[model samples]
Target: MLILECPYCGVAADETELSPGGEAHLVRQGPGSSDQELESYLFGRKNPKGVHFERWRHSYGCGKWFHAARCTMTLEVFATYSAQTPVPPKNVINAIKAKRPDWEGWT
Candidate 1:
């Protein structure tokens, strides 16, 4: 099992307590695209190796959403933080921040 540090909850938590959102949003290198194209680009994913930052929900813990970085090969959790937390390494912070969806208007 992996110990995931939740941004809202703090401390480490069992992997089972969190729901993994595979592969956080990737930046669009090229410009000039419609919403449908952008949505398709942003929503796409690739199960790659090495360190990958992903969104995770602490469903059983804080019940809030957050992010985590882990190794695809070993499943080793290297880092984690909430959406409100300060920036982290590997361009993840900015990536997640840029891709933050408008959840408030969802309902």
Candidate 2:
């Protein structure tokens, strides 16, 4: 069972208690953006085979959204952090690096 700790409420929520919000740190394209840019924003997303960062809403708990760093293949969770940031926290990145030495760093 996939579980994630809510950074806001500190609840160790199971997947049932949370809602997956797809990939995180997406740069939203707005008005005046090129068609390709808009299309990318709407369709392009990272589907990594290893470590992945994603958004989650603690719907059954605090009802807040947060980010999580986890392994896609093994389902191993590294860390969770606030969604307000534009990128994953350094500690989270380091944790991932610790687990996956050849991760090639976050893109």
Which pairs of residues collide in model 1?
A: none
> What tens digits encode model 2's per-residue C-alpha lDDT throughout 4-53?
99999888999999999999999999999999999999999989998999
lDDT of 1 by residue, 1-107 (tens): 88888767585778898887665545563478877778767776666665566788888877887778666778866567666543355454444344444212110
Cα error, candidate 2, residue 82 (Å): 0.4
lDDT (Cα) of model 2: 0.94
Q: Which residue runs of candidate 2 sit more than 4 Å off their true CA positions?
A: none
Clashing pairs in 2: none
Please report the candidate that would top TM-score against the real structure: 2
Question: Estimated TM-score per prediction?
Answer: 0.63, 0.97
- Cα deviation at 1, candidate 1, in Å, is 1.8
